[model samples]
Every structure is written in C-alpha cells, then in structure tokens.
Target: MPAARQHLFLLCLLLPISLSYEIQLILVNNCNYSVWPGVLGSAGHATPEDGGFHLGLGEEAVFDVPSWWSGRVWGRQGCGFDGQGKGSCDSGDCGGMLQCKGAGGAPPATVVEMTFGTDRSPLHFYDVSLVDGFNLPVTMAPVGGGVGCGVAGCEVDLNVCCPSKLEVKRNGKVVGCKSACLALKADKYCCTGDYGSPKICKPTLFSHLFKSICPRAYSFAFDDSSSLNICRASRYLITFCPPAR
Candidate 1:
C-alpha cells in the first residue's frame, strides 16, 4: 500500500479510541462523619465502584468514567453494614446494602447528576438536584475546564431549615428533607398528569423555597433554565457536605 493509504488506515483504526475519552471524577466526603457514596449509572451504562462504596470523613474516591457515561451520585449517612455487606442507612439507603450495586438510593437524598457527551457533541451537563430532596450539602465543580464551567450544588445544609412537613427525621433528628412531591404526593407537586408540561408545571411554594436556599441546584423538574450547567471538562470534584459558601 502507498504511504498515504497506510496513514489513512491507521487514522481510521484510531478514530474510535480518540472519540471514547474517559472522564475522571473525584468524590470527597467533607462531612464531619463517614458517608457511603452511592452511584447509579444510566440504563445500559456501566456502573462504577459496583454502584456504591464507603468514604470516611475527609476521604475521597476516584473513578474514570467513559465520556458517554450518564449517572447520578448520592451520599448515604448513618449506615451500618454487617460482615456480609447487608445493612441499611438512616438516609440514602439502597436496598439495605453497603454496596448499592446498581440500586438507586432512597430519598430524601441530595443527588449529583452528570451526563457526558460523546465526540459528536462534547459538552458535559451536570447539576446538583434537590428534586429528590436533600440529605446533605454537596457541590460539583470542574477542575481547570476553562471559563463558562459553572459549579452546581448546595453549600448550606437544607435539613436545618427544612419545613416541618417535609422533614425526614431519624431518632428525633432531621436527616433529610423531602420534596413536596414526596411529602404530599400530589400531582401538582410531582408535575404529573395535568401539570406535566413545563408551562403548566410552574414552581410550587416548596420548590420556590428550595430555589431560594440553593440557587445553583434543581429545585423542581423544570428548573433547566438556571439549574442546568454545561461545560467540557475531564475532571470534576464532587464534595459531599461541602463547606457553606
């Protein structure tokens, strides 16, 4: 084969590898206590760390996810796993297991969501969502991903100010805050049925309160205009129980 043809063949063979980049995520537990981080990859995607793992106070966990990975991360508190990894948590429990293993955490749990784009569309979208309610303060910030990469999270503890009706208490102490949809189970609050569309599903009083406290997070389903953040970064820092801003 001619030199030019050989070079073209090599390029073709390498194209797919170049397109499938890996993204690094550094998850830190900054809370005063230990936290079990739960991961739930989107359908058909690979779940890292077997879906969950333990992170002691001041400790961190790192993983390299495919650029096409889309998933949600959350923290489980007050957990107790037996020798066989069978146990539960006061908040964010996933089927009473230490390793969530593809299971989603039980709300009310603070959630960090990320959807990375493939080579065809390289933008990464992320948000700290309170839609399932808040178990702890958390933040997701890009590392050295140039300007326009906004941070998404809530720095302040929401459980402290959680409304009485939405509080998830454990042992007489508030551990999580439930969304109105979870607390009331009303179609209007859940944005179901007649209130499904963005136009019809405006923010409710509870969501408005959440927005006021955490402006950078998703207070409801239609909070895309402000809560959704876009960027292109290979590394992200997700801190649970992040310091208050």
Candidate 2:
C-alpha cells in the first residue's frame, strides 16, 4: 500500500476510539415506589432514552450522552400512562405524555442540569436545582472523583418541612414543595425587575431556608458560583429519593 493510503487507513481505524468519549448518566430510582424519569435536552441537544421511561423501585437506567450534551432530568411520581404513552403524573408531569421528548417538567419538581465538555472547553458543569421547587430528593455525583469535583443535590426530602402555603398536595399529602417565587410570582420573589442580578437579588427568607437545607443545590435564580459545579468525568450518577444525610 502507498504510504499516504496506509496513513489514511490507520486514521480511520482509530477514529471511532478517539470519538468514543461519552458522558454516562446512571439514573437510579431509590424510592420505595416506582417513578418515571423525565429528560429534557437543551436547545440543539438530543434527548436520550426516548426522553422518558419508567423505573420501578430500586431500578436504574443508564444513558450514553454525547460529549457537549446539555439537558435536565427529573422524576415523576404516580404516573398512569396508557399503551400509547398518554397520562398524568402526581408531580413533574410533562404535557400529559409518558415521553417528555423536549418538554420540560412542571414546576415543583427537583431538577438536575448538566452540560458536558466541548473541544474548546473540557470542564463539565452540573447542578441540582430546587429553584422550581422539590417533589423528590435527588443527588448527583461523579462516578470517579476528579480534582475539584463536588457532589450537588438536596439529600433531604423538602416536602416534610414544606411551608403550608407553598405545599403542593395530592390526595391530601404533600407531593411537592413550592418555591416562594413559584408560589407568589412577585418580582422580588422571582428575582425579576431590579432584582435580576446576583448583586441585587439576594436570598430571601425562603431561599435562605432552602439553602440551609440543601446547601449544594441551587435555591434560586442567580445562585451561581456557589451552587454551580465544574468537573471532568466520564460518568455521573443521579439518584432519585436519595438517602438522607
């Protein structure tokens, strides 16, 4: 074979391995009951696992997300879906569909957001957010620890202590906790108008309570720097109904 042809063949042989780096997300359901895992990819990103799937108690689903993928994941409880995938959930329902596709979960749901690395940037960013509210406990941690990689999530079940006015009830039970912003929708609570920046939108009493309970999770808008985590890892584990700390 010609030298150039030999070189080209070798490159082709190694290309798949070189581009095989992926972010493996293991979604584990640790609750006593079954839960449906909902996934929503960011703009231009592809939702994996058909966007949603059912996970019985103690079951887990693994997804191989391409590098640079950006998306959010959450859990839905008490969902009743027909064969055609049409249904409603007690919490975190996405347009009455079993597969969320690109649809985001309803408010009062705990969310895990992740952005993987790109060629220009190698750092992966991830965080658990309670800014919308909390329906279930969640935790996100790298499979293998990397330098400066920190776990982010709310290990405690916020529903137990959810304020009466901010509680979302289903069958006379608190199914989810509502953020003051979602409960009130005021500019001050939502961090809008003049209170849009980190400098101005300081944590409120409610936000402070959430932060105290889940210090690593994002409690409100502009809760960056402290809540946002940067790491580089090949795999991450997201547990629903995470064990209490």
Candidate 3:
C-alpha cells in the first residue's frame, strides 16, 4: 500500500508527452530510496553497470527511450540487492535481476506520466482488461451470451446488433452517428419478423435507444471506459463493434 502505488493504480499515458525516444527512461525517488535505469543505450535495454541505478527520496532521473526499439516500455524496480528500494534484495524473481517481476520491486507510481506518446497512443494499460469486445469481468467463459434469451445455453452467449445508421457526436458537438451497438451489455434485437423478413430491432428502435442511452452518460472520448459499466441491466444493448464470429 505504498503512496505512489495507491494513487497511480493504472494508466497508459503513452510516452511522447514531450518527445519520443528523446526521453524514454525516468527515475523517481518518491520512495524511501530511489532507482534509475542507468544508461541502457538505444536498444531500450539496460545492462548491469548500466542497471541498478539508484536515487534518493524526492530525486528524479530521466533517460531517452532507445531509438531502435518500438513497443511497450517501463521503468520498474528490480528486486535487487539489499531489497528493492533501499538496494536491499529479493530472495526470488529478479533477486536483483532487471526486468524480473517488471519492477514489481516497488509499489505503483505516484509521480506518473506527465504526457503521452505522439508516434503512437501513450498507454501503459492493464493489458488484462481488454480483448476485443469481450471483457473477463462482465462475462467469464468464452461462451458469448447476448444472442439468445430465456434459453438454456448457446455458443454465442453475448449477442449484438446494429441500427441502419448511428447518430454520433463528440463533446456535445454532434459529430454524427452510425447505427450499431448503442448499448453495451449485449443487445437483443427484435425477432418479430414481417412475413419472414427477419424482424429485429430496426433503425428507429436503436436510434431511439441510442438517443435515450449513450449521449446522456457517455461521449466519444470515453471509448476508454467500459461500455458495460454504464448501463446496469437491459434486454436490448447496442454496440459500435462486436467480437468476431
């Protein structure tokens, strides 16, 4: 329950808030002691003499991300000698090894990213939370749910449907719309077919739903927030996207 760990529980602020590769590595001594990535070179990799870098409380270090590499990066505390922060050590994991436990050596960060990456989206996220439209929290097993109702079980548990068009907007500016999953849970469209025309929730139904549902609590920018979280329970849900069949 370190101070830094508590506040900065999660994030993905990207890197280039200032300039990509220009400043990739940074050190913060908000802990009892401090640590640095030392000089890892352009490979975005740090070596021994280069690793085990240390700092004092209230201290800060900054290093440029290696120019050669591209992907996710981090400044983690190694369970090194003495033990994590104070140079103490860990009996297991990185036992002082770099990249071990992913700097689990210390708690989360308090002085977090001040900016984001430009070349790409600056994000150090819980890669665990997202995977297509399927989130482990809402539905456990891979069995998709929404498609059927009052039924026993089915392969696609989660169902999805889109309107003829979706009226979209951003920041209250009315960006436009596209008929799609206006609701997050898993929309159950109208099966009321007309002369076997395959009746389902039509554009008007979904359009009305979106008008009544999304805009009030959500916006375009909130794509980061879980759509399932907004609405509690519903027989019909809408979505801009859905998992692959």
Candidate 4:
C-alpha cells in the first residue's frame, strides 16, 4: 500500500484508543494493621506493621467520587449518592456511596481502576460499616463494636427511621432528592414494630435505621458471619466504579 494509505490505516486503529482514558483502582491498605485481612484466608495480603485505625476485612472506603462515576449506583436503604437515597428504589434502600453486605448478587468482583477496562464498575473508597470499637470477632465481643473515629473514621451518623425525612446532600450538594423523596417506605419503616428499639430507632428525633450500635471505642458491624476475616485486621476490601470518558 502507498505511504498515505498506510498512515490512514494507523489512524483508524488508534482513533478509538484516544477517546478512552485509564482509571486506577488504587488500594492504599489503610489503617496499618499489616496482618493481611483475607476472605478465604488466602485471598489478600496485609502490608504495614501498623498505622492509624485499621479498617479490617470486608471494610471498603468511599473516596471522593471520581469524575467518571456520575451515573446511578446501587445505594442501600437511605444514603443517596445521586440525590435519591434507598427510598427511590422499589426496595426503598438507596444511598450515596454505600457498603452492602455481599456484591449485590453480582459476579466475583475484580476491583478496577481504569474507566474503560474489562473489569466492572470502578467505586472509589467504599462506604464502610461498623460493629463498634471491638476489633475482635462477634464471638469475642458478644455485644459488637463502636467507633474510635476522628474524621473519615468517625461513626457515620444518619437518622435511621426518622418520622420526618430530613434533607440529603453530597458534600453540601443535593444528590438523591425530590421533595417528598425522603418519605419512609411502607411496611418497612413503620412507626410500629421492626427496629423499634432505640438501637434501631431513635424515637426522639427519628430512629436512625442505619447508625451503628457501638460504644465510643468499638463499631457496629453489619454482618456477623464475616467476623473471622474482619478480626484478622489485615486483609481489606475496596470498591470503585470504572472511570468515565
């Protein structure tokens, strides 16, 4: 082929490549437990000896959202990332940057960094849950943990089953919202039973359907079954959305 034709062919091949950008799912191995909190006991490896408060296993971080993850995400019962908390979904469990128990029935997730890669969505730091301050397993604490939180580690506070739905915001900007969008889910956050206890419901302001029932030290863990891995305090997990164009 002539030189001009060859150059044209090269441009055609590279055109698609230029439009896409690379995103990184960088893992910081925060908290410095350095013990390698693993899933199957052989999955992940811990690094540092110690640093700040160890995040433990199954604990993901929700870093400042990337510019690419602008669409909707799987929010749980209340926290809304895009202005609509769990209340928007049919299940009424949406929230901004949430940490769910399992992978919401998705395939074995491969934490990704780039926006246009083969891996699935890229989630910045996952919104982690707590079981209070007790770093040990449930068998050890029996009552569970609380928070030794400072800033990001501070026990994420939220009005659980509040009677009057308060406003929601993402860094001062409304994300998941639409006037009455904060309305409570029927048969779910009823004023009757189900999470009526102060632990589940505050009753004064409104029950905090999601706040951790932990002391000043320990954290309120979500799923007890995952305690073993969490106790390791080494192996940790992080989720993210694929970077955007």
C-alpha TM-scores of all predictions: 0.94, 0.93, 0.25, 0.24
Between 2 and 3, whose TM-score is larger? 2
Residue 92: error of model 2 in Å? 0.5
- Tell me the deviation in Å of residue 108 in model 2: 0.7
Q: Candidate 2 — worst ten consecutive residues by lDDT sum?
A: 15-24
User: In candidate 2, how many Å is residue 156 off?
Assistant: 0.6
The lDDT per prediction is: 0.92, 0.91, 0.27, 0.24
Which candidate tops lDDT?
Answer: 1
Q: Rank the candidates by lDDT, best first.
A: 1, 2, 3, 4
Against the true structure, candidate 2 reaches a TM-score of: 0.93
Estimate the TM-score for candidate 3: 0.25
After the best TM-score superposition of candidate 4, give how far the Cα of residue 62 lies from its true spot, in angstroms.
14
- Cα RMSD to the true fold for all candidates: 1.8, 2.2, 22.7, 18.5
lDDT string for model 1 (116-225, tens) is: 98877889999999999999999999988644699899988989999999999999999999999999999899999999989999999999999999999989888866
The residue-level lDDT of candidate 1 at 109 comes to 94
